[model samples]
Target: MRNILILLTAASIAACNQSSSTMNEYKWPADVKPPIAGKEPKEFIAHGDKRIDEYYWLNQREDQKVLDYLKAENTYLDTMMSGTSNLREKLYTEMKSRIKEKDESVPYKDNGYWYYSRYEEGKQYPIFCRKKETLDAPEEIMLDQNKMAEGFKYYSIGGTAVSDNNELLAFTVDSVSRRLYGLQIKNLVTGVIYPETITNVEDNDIAWAADNKTIFYVKKDITTLLGYQVWRHELGTDPAKDVLVFEEKDNRYYIGVYRTKSKKYVGIYSNMNQVSSEFRLLEANHPAGEFTIFEPRKENFQYSIEHFNNKFYVLTDWEAPNFRLMETPEASTAKENWKEVLPHRKDVYISGMVVFKNHLVLSEMKDALNQLRVINQTDHKDYYIPFSETVFAAFQNVNPDYNTNILRFSYTSMTTPRSIYDFNMDTQQRELKKQQEVLGGFKQEDYTAERLWATARDGAKVPLSLVYKKGLKKDGSNPLLLYAYGSYGYSVAPGFNSNIISLLDRGFVYAIAHVRGGQEMGRQWYDQGHLFNKKNTFYDFIDCGEYLIKEQYTSTAHLYANGGSAGGLLMGGIVNFRPDLWHGVVADVPFVDVLTTMSDPSIPLTTGEYKEWGNPADSAEYFYMRSYSPYDNVEKKAYPNMLITTGLHDSQVQYFEPAKWVARLRELNTSNNKLLFKINMDVGHGGASGRFDYLKDKAWQYAFFLALEGKLE
Candidate 1:
């Protein structure tokens, strides 16, 4: 069941550090510490008699994405040949036993009504909470997943959102496509989807104009990499109601979208040779055609066009590596007309910006700790929102009906599940939502979030987040699972995950290492950890393991590391770079071979993120990527127990990467054995079926964790 860890000339726990008692300074070979333990460390985990490519077919999905490879081979591997039966069958067989059925008696999260979607037979279908009795009832309409799998009509929505006058109900039904979709409309009290014309027109995102008459959404032309066109659709009896916006020739550049706050349109369009942005005022009364362009910066990169305070605000790296923002009057023109408000002073990318009634809100990060700041539109001054040092937080939406100056957001860290709060602008009083209560019959007071530092190879301190039961001392006595993802600009925020409750209730401690690659700290934090900085992510992860030991949060023998997708890379890197520090490892759909993976540009995020991870064609970048790639780094030596998982249909991080990495590892490492692998026959990158299917995945990982290290009786 496990891909026993290969023996390696692995770097000892001491080689990773300089302390005299540290494991060892040099990398040790696998044969040096053969995996002789009955923990089954020496067995190869591959499915014997099964060709690697055979699993490819069972798991292979003929998504349009794989067309390029199939065409190159002059083969038509379309649905006509493979179909989706195998996938559905695999999911039904693998996931049915893993999760509890959607029994109406079993309650779900309090966010909505917990019941089964009888419409769908096997899926843990979305439950419809249609009381509509109170205003506070489930208002955020539509679960994106439900819409994706079950279609628009059958899915359910939470929370109700009535227009300013309650004349129209602006509800969104979330559906899945290549991306999650929102089926939106102003209900005329008909229990059916309206505007038959709009219904036939396929569009994932649907945001209503303030007047509720016009709709704003992007029309994606998937011919090229970035061929999304922003369109404005007027909801009336007229058949030809929708119109092309920005009407530009370059499909990649003519990306227009409606901004919620200012109720205006923003997008980066090209003018002659220079690429810039255009802002348009879009309300029910004010139609398209009357548009305005603002702030013509010389340089061209990714910039955000937003409407705030009845004006336009542009956040772009036109002048710096990071984002700097500026605002213009009602119709400020050109680059010179712009006045800088928030300068791009540091390294982190801008996560989000919000405008409250009285205060213009800004959430920045030294790394990724939502550093809240408020700019009084009245006084034109910036004031830091008062809050303690916390990582991964945000300013929630505002209640439009109430004129009260207030804001809301949820914040948390390694140990904290989530503490949602409503902050009043005038009174500065905070109201807690749900009060950080622990579910699945557990106690919150039992766990704590520890903000510790793990210095990387260059002495830069990487942050580590730890959550353990209150009674557990820093004696390194309990099993520890350190999780992290250090790729792209994806910030691993400090919020609560209810599913994690499963692991927490078991007396096992959970720690999230906010290493360098994450925006947890800020811009500089990510820069130091991306591309050529990639090794920093791995080293930072290793340092986190070492820090946990030094802090006595856990011992080397009880420590484990895990990550998925990009984070899966984190799992592989930590194991390869410093295998001795971890007692076990799990890599899910890992991109362990960076150079090889990156060379293949057809991957979903690969093209755009080439800017983040260097182009391997460049010798320097290739050398750097290879230095940390887990697949290339795998050496014959003593290593820890491990689990590797992948979905045959995974289009993002291909299943082949993880499969190959594990195979190579099993063949190479002769360590203490205990290596494992699981490839879901039906799934894709997520490799999950339904709700229960996903949970079963979690349970399997957790079961392995408890068996290997929880020291269960």
Candidate 2:
């Protein structure tokens, strides 16, 4: 490996001509060259297929050569984007001004307390607080995360639980940005944190038993980062003496433990490949009792359980593709003994359910939109909470009481701020508790949002949600940004983003493409977008971009694309499929080396996601993945301007994936378009931990787009 410092110094002198009056006239000096990684060819032979991967040496995280390359890439990114430094700062300040710094969340009543979180004027983290039984009661500070995170560069608080006696608080903290949390118990009354800390536990896996002294949590596999072991710990006892309550032997399944909303049972759930799941239950009162299987696991069968009034409600996809609801007595816990509560509708996908004493709430998806259905358990009558916007998102909020008629949920659209509401199931009335406050005189009336459908090559209608400033002309000259995440059955909702207002105010249209790999249109949508049919996801996004161009919303010269993680994979795919469709692209923590990563089970999500991306061990699946893999398919062609970002500590998609991808793209690309990579040394998959700090990354991304569009005023 060459000394990067010497090369960078030489390139800096050669690229000194940075006096362009407009961003569109800027160009890289012919003598200046980006850092070139050495090719160490590694051959992977599987199923009689031979593939040689260069830049494979970049995966050596401990090697100084690999570190030098990554640092050089970061330096190159800084050098290339130096001209936009002022614009980036301006954009950052513009976006940050819209946020209300000293804000508090709407309090929700739970376990005889009104719980909420609040942020101080200049704090990066929130303070967890609660009031006893009434809104007007004296506030009790549960946890001051800003104080706890004072010395850490990256910090996050995961699941938190108050003991049954309300004297102790169990919380998980992750300081390394790897999603491996450390469990700590705090004495709320004395304000003393216990000395015993359990390490390597999964986030959001902490549950308190009724005894209050005993709590259950899932431990992760150090290598794969899978939470496979459930353990029980007693207060004031050494964590080394904790008992292993359950261990999932299957590597394909991840497990977690939680207490039921009714407070009657503690359940451990095991989910496999997103296609099958099984549950085990133990009476909450019996902290020492053994768990009994709620139902044995079966292939392609998935069900979730909730308890209420001595009966267990089950949401299952047993014979329905979109899922249905069923119920059975607590004593007779078997699929055969279950009776239908709500038959599955072909058009409506039941995503989740909440059980209450007198009413049941179902969160459903129809026409790529969220719908909240409330049903009276006594009268068996149901009604949906109506939303006027054609493209909006609604989700059930915290309703821990299980005995109240009031259902709390959140609603938001592209043009609307996120608002919390309390809806009465009995009276069919709704009360607005609070809406997110956008500072700097923000007004919803100044913006407009609409839904559009694009026709794919196979005649599939892909939904697109777009928002822009009012009185915008439908001209082909406008700049538009398209985003999507079409994988893992995760739907990209048309939610509100106050940060996007900066782009809207700058005459840029922001849109979300609800492509096929997501569950936006139900299970069938996901089924068609993954595995052998994964290319459909990329095609759908391309079609949406073309549709916008055809409708005079934007043209290829002014179109931009952005996606993160799996959506980053989408960005990689689309750029390969149709490089000329985008003027600029931003891929954050992308998974681009698909065939190689899928073939290695040691990777974090490889084995568990075989069903989503086909198992490459099979010969047929190998060829299919290779057909569209961004890294494998990189050819000698002109490529779009790209900004690739990654975190060195990212656990979901290894940082090496994008590092290797940038090297390969630069090697094969024949165009002079900007190809830059930025690596965050302190963060993970989710960028910076601080609330306001993340906006800097967003501002940098927006600056990239604005610079390309010549809007860098």
Candidate 3:
């Protein structure tokens, strides 16, 4: 379970006066003291194999020793990096300068109101507002997040849904950053809060039924934190009184609730990792009625349905690896009743679909590029919304209304700002609604984006998307940072990021390895990189780095690597396999302790990922996982300079994984190159909550790269 709809400040702290310490100057390979984790050996024996974990005590988060060790690590990191304070501030300022302080998202219409979110000059939170009927109407503040977040160090607002009459509003909030949210309501007309509250529900996942008073939301597993049960609640009632409508018995499957676009049915979706899925439907008009299965779940079956024109349009991988579209009458819900609407293509992957009154929009990924196609339902004339860039990402934007012929979508590339457009399907014309405002005179022409291919050991061509300053030479004189997240079939799109401009302008080349384990190259690509074939992911990344060096993009001395979460896992894998290839590495909340974590079923995502990473209880999976698990495979050898980060409250990839990892590396690593650890005591998986503050971490990381290159001034 990777969250699909998962959605950080700087300067003054970096300038804080440094306190005197034993280490007078920052030195690489210096005789410095690192925190030594206590050796409380824990024996793990399975499948006739035995191992001892010396740092296993770090997982006891509630113990005082663990907290003290983490704090000590932070202190050590700050001391080691004290010399680069100025560079950090300079980088932070430069990165922050590109952003527009006062910005508002494009307003979208839903029901009778036009809604949007805007940020003030220096505010860290968004002000959600809406106007009735027309844009000229007076702004009604739906949620003043700035005021609500006044005293909280970390805060987030989850999904917000308004009543049918547009009077009552519901939203979820999280102050601890653990993904557990508190549900609350407000009377939009009266500007008053409700008395009812729900605790420990999943983040922002609620569906309002037609009754306006009843809503459906999913409850998380108390210990594991996975959304396993769907609950129905009525307005003004105690959450304890809420009815449990559905509970997914299989731990491998996760449950979620959402209302259909046509507003006719409320759908409850239960899915396994890209393998099998089942959806149940309840008539929105009859919220109290029991939901019925659209079609029974079958082995290897995967389908997502959208209601349109008295029919259910299904996008499924049943007998079609790339997925195809089939339609069935709303009243008859069975695979036998399906009629092919769009035939499957081996080369094209239908990522998603949206149905309109007169048109149907398909988000197709071909050659690692997203393409938007609009089909006229009545005339059967289909055409693509043309894009100008050869390497860009284009997908549907916020489209709430189902009756419009104009399709709203967003397009962006490594060089282009995020551009929103409204395409008229009837007239075959596109109107630019808005483009992200990059203040301080930014231009797309200053950068270049290119796609390259690297041959893996097995001769499989791996795609790489790269961007750099215009006229960048292939000579190995520039600094290059290679990044990848080769897991869970997640496609990392080559989208624009204003912060990256700092690197490009500073003579750095950034490349993303579209390796296996991601769906960018279609289903087969992902299949080959996971489970028993997982080694392909690490091998492909290493080969890509080798390819870049062979082509003179940059030498190993100037090369760095980065990845967060599962991508952090990539960072771990690559470093373990080819430590000499990278000069520096940033592993953000890395899942380095894969073998041990997967051996337990109580961890948040471990059980559900059995299909993704095979169940280690089996002898073969255990042996295979142990062979490559980063922490398990860490050797007593010279390693790259590394900065490992973690969050105290991270639900996914617990902080201990990295904490224990740093401890073991410190004990055995033969290199004196920096091995720094920093833990955000307040936040979770997604770091700092503010927009500007998030950039501070990136600035520090870039500053680290500069320092490693001996260019810090």
Candidate 4:
């Protein structure tokens, strides 16, 4: 689930002059001890069951004791792993070497400007710039994020919208990493920023009202951080005077505003429990007009709209579980009036679509692989854009223009660096605009990428994407890292990752388990792994690990598991289900307190996630979740070495969840194995804001695995 607060890779460590040794051989300070949290038991009685939480007191973020405990844990980790400082630095340098220090994104044309972002040679942030009319024109600096980020410890720029006249730029920024962005406007022509600012706006939810002065943005609830209200604000006016255009009374729905590619209408989208959605549309020309409901909300009904020509195209799951494309006249925008444009197929899932003057491109998924189907509007003829790699990811890119025959998309695989291309629908030709330049001496042929299938315990075939240096032998001796995020119907793509190259080059096999709970194999795949069948996700991941061991790709002595957020939940569950199967595990910002989180609607994502993980207020659902909850299932048994990470200000899964889970695991674990926790006091769910800074966290993780593998030098 993309919406689930998942941790993106980021980290850093101080330089130390120390000799590195393997975990088993490294000397530890005799007096150094792990910080033990003083527990105060709190009991919750629900559904005729009582759960005693010993570390519930850690939830107090404002408490000095909680902060001290987190700091102590960090200090303890630094002391225990201090010997691997050199190894971490080496890994960080190696990984950073692969990235081009100064790079620019492919310029995309929108409105009358060719807009793109580029980083300076040594800058930590990008500078957004544009050229008027043509690429050859003089560059116009819209926003220099590098300059804006100078004074803040953490800064992020969210959605940026250029008015229809291309003179005013509306953007959102988050300085504290809580994802509560503040909306601001800049006059590109005058080089002056507007004084009026809107606070607590949703990230990437701002849309210009064709009038240029008026804009629509979603306001987030101060407590839950849920974007529930849509507001209309006019330039030069105080934001406090803004009108509340729409308010979603249902706590189950998350709302956002976006403009159509054709610039015809602005829409307010309401996503209901990730299972259904509703949209309100208004003409972009009428800023003060009320938005009419395109379609009322329905249970289990999902649809998305695209405007082109004179009709509205909808990608809907009304009668198709895998979804299909339909078209409805602009005057009649109801489900009954919708006519099928592309019929549904059991084998293929219509994931997304893009509208243009002469072509309609559909992003479809089949057998866990992505494909782009292009259709000719005149003749209704369709064909797929071919990809040579057996396991790769290809998806639509920035194509905001509606009258162009060219389509932009990105393609990448485990071995292939991400490449951008512009395909001409009329000529059946493609031009490679740019391919990521790996600064290090990296070659595609030096590594091997292959797709393997593992049969789950229930006989379902789960796919695994593997990548390693060439000449990897199936001897069950090589160290392997398996990753997955099997929730929210979000499919993990087999895309190229420059950071993983550091692991691959170090004789480590990197693989992604396309397990259940994700829509890798289509909608049914996700349905089977969520709610009552959620355990299927855990079972499938464990089955993949067992199959890998059985096939000699790796063994219990050398196999490791890694995941963040929901995937982190997978890491926790797998270790409990089969602790002896893994040598070490890294759970990043994991959501382990499942029953407690789902039972409390006050949590950020709790109310909206009832459909994903059943409402735990019910007896059956409560018991089911408790049965597998990592924090609840900790037992007095030998467990694998683990490193858990969390952020102080994470909005997704609160830091307290991991903090509490770790405290419980320490109480019950019977093994002498290390259980280290590293909490970043500065950043939120996603670690560092800078590109290179995030690699430090990656390096920290790699060093942990290398130390366990005795590969540290």
Candidate 5:
């Protein structure tokens, strides 16, 4: 392999219950032992670097020993958590009690029907229903997931679309939790199912053409699992005869298909990892017509389109890092003809938009808080909906009708419940539609949320969103759990979650670090934390932990770190960099083997993520990834207590990554502190599918933390 110095110059450097069980109740029998995976070294050579992976054999999912090992780990986890069985049950019950047994979502009018979903008293799934003409009309049951999921142990209903005539329903379902949903059509009036089934397609990329019988769906790449092909299938015909509408040949882009809000055009969009995108449009009335490119793809140019009248409104980052709004004639859809409608600002980020007849609602993020800006296009005036909370998330909700005076949006915070509201864009009046019901005496006044800033090593200020019970003291004695997911420019909203009530009630401070890897602070924040500058994510998180301690919010003895997936990678980095800062760490399905995983193109997300986490084939990226990858940096010294969890069939972060990390940690760690590993046999990346079943896993996790604190009573 060649050295990186030759090409380095051109690259831009972006930037729960506890339970104290009765000692006998929770303790595992001393005879039972932890699983120790046997190693057969495999040489991985990349960028002229050779690394020996002893646990590479664990990746062989079909091997009996691998299955036995995963099962053994599960057994060990159960035995270890047995002492906290009572606490786990109590936590589960408390969490479940807070959720309303029977709940219904707010109905939003779309086309001619008011659509919504509701749950029965004890069902794990929801029943999708709709009312025609008015809310008082008879309710029609489109699909009851409770019935479709009766036989499958794991099932999920993804995106759903109704034809223009409202006679047929197109939906996707995943039975194995791998995200490969099969498309099925249902006749609403006849109450019959179409025989044709489309398999191996994406869950959220389904669109119905105006013809009602023609549908466009995205096909997932069998090997990479990337949505790369858009196919059109005619109802009643075999899926084998589906015509390929478009295929994204670029390895860097992912494909998606959807209908415009006007329902006038079906669009196919190819989004590059992060920097660019290309969109194609086809009139909905002409299902068999070719899709014309809205704008040719250009490097570092990202834009999204929405059709309105005779023009296309675009949100692009052409010359603005924070993004701006542009409009172009529908017939002359090209970058050269695009005219600026809303210029970008340095302080505010245009996150999203929802177009209406006379107004345009933009979801903006400013000062780390979401602001809903309602722009009256007719009057050329705009105003923001006010929010009282210091740390909260607000975004446009379901507003399907393109012609409406009401703008539906949602708002929530750590203490506040998820509430939906309808605001009259013309009258400037807001009406509360529905607020989430939290049973078991949950009160927003009992808790408080605040925002803090942590100064990073580079002098950059990273925002931290925190929430805790009122009347708590800043004495450095409180136990705190710092969490974050600083990757893919995905911001972790400070949203409400009823389950967290248990922790707040027990005097725990939950904090989310708005690290550089996320878009919380803007595109620059994300750019500074990715690729060669990836270490900023880890450093930002560590700084937040340190700031919490310095301000007396928590102490090193009572501090805990929690993160999953990429955030799990943060946990791994922090524990390796500053082991003494945390008492315990919970890494859920972590991506710890960065260099090795990125080097393998066969992995699910490796190929498309080359731009995000530089391709390891390049020596510069290879050395940089190895420098911080958790598995490669396991040191022969004391480490913090840790509980690592993974699922056998995870498509995102392969289960073997965490398994191998744990095995290596067991071999090198010099600490006697607790180290546990668990693998869910029946589920994938997201864990249990059932509503209550998912809480059981959480109950077990909470019990682990409580046990560490000696608070399990």
Candidate 6:
């Protein structure tokens, strides 16, 4: 509320699509619609801010009337932030005290170090990383400061990926050039760090090849978001060993790569957001053909694949409305390229492939919950691993030593804390390596998890997960915080967060609205909510909110909504479409300007998102997207109190979108509840780099939700 001042730029948003849709040089309106997944955009137009602002502001008489009406309503800033913060502070303090009741000693390492990052309030260096844990927590120092003083600002360490041989460690660094980052490789044995080796490359995504001979990274020209290419670099090849790899002939397409069972393939998924994807595969060996383009099931369908259990497994809806996988023998790209390992079904999706020794683990998507399916690739027998209704999202890289026998995976959900566990591929014996426990002495028994359902306007069922204290009654009188992310075909996986403990301990229930635009309910579920059909997200969230109150999980007076980025669009649409449904809303780094944001060619994410958000100016699809553009739909009413925060460095959802949305909301709302904006100046789309800072913001956000639910005050 106090510090941030919008710097040099204060322009309206632009709209466009991915795949050279951005590079094609198109004129944009001063305003645009929200981003939705659909066909490539084909038109051009400009919007006047005055047109929409007049309904909320510009016209003093009408604006003042709306403002006066909202002035007397119970809003978030006055009720939720004030009340919830108090309850959370009390609950968090109580939980921390209980945990501290014992001076538990965690194993410390020698020459071993646990490193973390830091950002000072007003120093010349805005960001730095500190070494801790292995040694007693010491004075935090800048990460790789390396004696450079003036103008050597804006550097932070991205997460690291170690080579299989442990010889090289490739990481990314953000120098803030147009707010893009570069991938640099370092010899772990030699202590030789390659800073700026892949200089000025856009995006922080980088991966190391299995042979360790090459490191692959993504590069996008600063001038054009659509001009993106994936490149590979071999050490000692040149000053940076930078060698051009596969540069897409079509600037509209983008590629994603992942490793599967003894083999690695760069998945050439999609160029734009048009819902179509297929990939060309590259093997380390094979002179006759180093890479083979896999036959696509359909031109209209897009997909992603994972290699596990000696089989080529992928998620696609080619065979049916829902996405299943066609997997073949892992090493035998020799004969047939891909075979239907799992035939498609119209009802569900199969994801998260984890190959343990000779066995495979998969997460099956059936409407709401993710079911675990483990099978022996050779014997073709079901392991029937039951998880007591817990959603097993996906399995990450397993530890090497147990690759042949035991399988390790990390799983989380709304109610459970994120936990890392290892299981035997044969006996299914499980050991818990880590459970993000309450910091001091908090107990898991204090919380309970449940599945709830709400039917959408189209008679579609939305499954939701709720986590809260064990003894809470069914009367729904408890304060509620509902969350959702209904875009990108990405299913919101159930995982645990320690912060949820703070809320559960305070009698607050956290609910996840498993809505459309996500693969949670399978491919058809996603299709039902994308691009022109995007309004399904709002209707889904509203249904979830109304269901909560109807079930007595929470009163309408105590209901709150929260989402960030794509999900932020969800929060925006909900309050705008159904204002009386919520007490408070937190839309973090939201893309509210939708159609206009997509139209902007200069914005980092527009071109790439066109497939997701229809190009409003050029296509009939734009009319569908126009129906849900929130910025253009705000009504003169007592809207819920809101908090919109973003990072100045965020490229995905530009800071201007939230800033302008707030500016408009201030004029439109009749309520006097404070609308707060917190900007993390030195970070990107996700906000801060450090885990502690993220938790701080998380607490602040939930505190805001509590204030809205009437608990904090």
Output the number of the TM-score-best candidate.
Answer: 2
Query: Candidate 3: lDDT of 552?
Result: 95
In model 3, how large is the Cα lDDT of residue 214?
Answer: 94
Question: What are the C-alpha RMSDs, in order, of all predicted structures?
Answer: 11.4, 1.6, 5.1, 4.5, 7.3, 11.3
lDDT of each: 0.55, 0.90, 0.88, 0.90, 0.87, 0.61
Error of 3 at 92 (Å): 1.4
What tens-digit string does per-residue lDDT give for candidate 2 at 1-713? Answer: 43333256755644653633653544444445688887778899988878888888788778888888888888777777776777789888888888788999999988888999999997889999999999999999999999999889999999999998889999999999999999999999999999999999998988899998999999998788889899999999999999999999987887899999988888999997559999999998998899999999998999999997888999999998899999999999999999998998888899999988899999999888998999999999999999888889999999898879999999999989999999999999999999999888888999999999999999999999999999889989889999999998999889999999888988999999999988889899998999999999999999999999999999999999999998999999999999999999999999999999998888886778888888888999999998998888888899999999999999999999999899889889998899989999899999999998999999889988887887767
TM-scores for candidates 1 onward, in order? 0.71, 0.98, 0.96, 0.97, 0.96, 0.76
lDDT of 1 at 142: 26
* Model 1 residue 616 lDDT score: 67
Higher TM-score: candidate 1 or 3? 3
Per-residue lDDT of model 4, residues 206-282, tens digit only:
99999989999999987888999999999999898999999999898889999999898999999975499999999
lDDT of 5 by residue, 79-145 (tens): 6666677778989999999989799999998888999999898899899999998999999999999
Model 6, residue 641: what's the lDDT?
70
Q: What is the number of residue pairs that collide in model 4?
A: 4
Q: For residues 374-442, what per-residue lDDT tens digits would candidate 1 score against the true structure?
A: 676778766666665454455454433123466666656555555667777656677765444443345
Let me know the TM-score candidate 4 reaches against the reference structure: 0.97
| Stretches > 4 Å off in candidate 1 | 1-188, 194-204, 209-216, 219-227, 231-256, 266-302, 316-325, 342-350, 381-383, 388-394, 398-404, 413-417, 498-507, 686-693, 710-713
Q: Looking at candidate 2, what is the lDDT of residue 353?
A: 93
Candidate 6: global Cα-lDDT?
0.61
Off by over 4 Å in 2: 1-6, 10-31
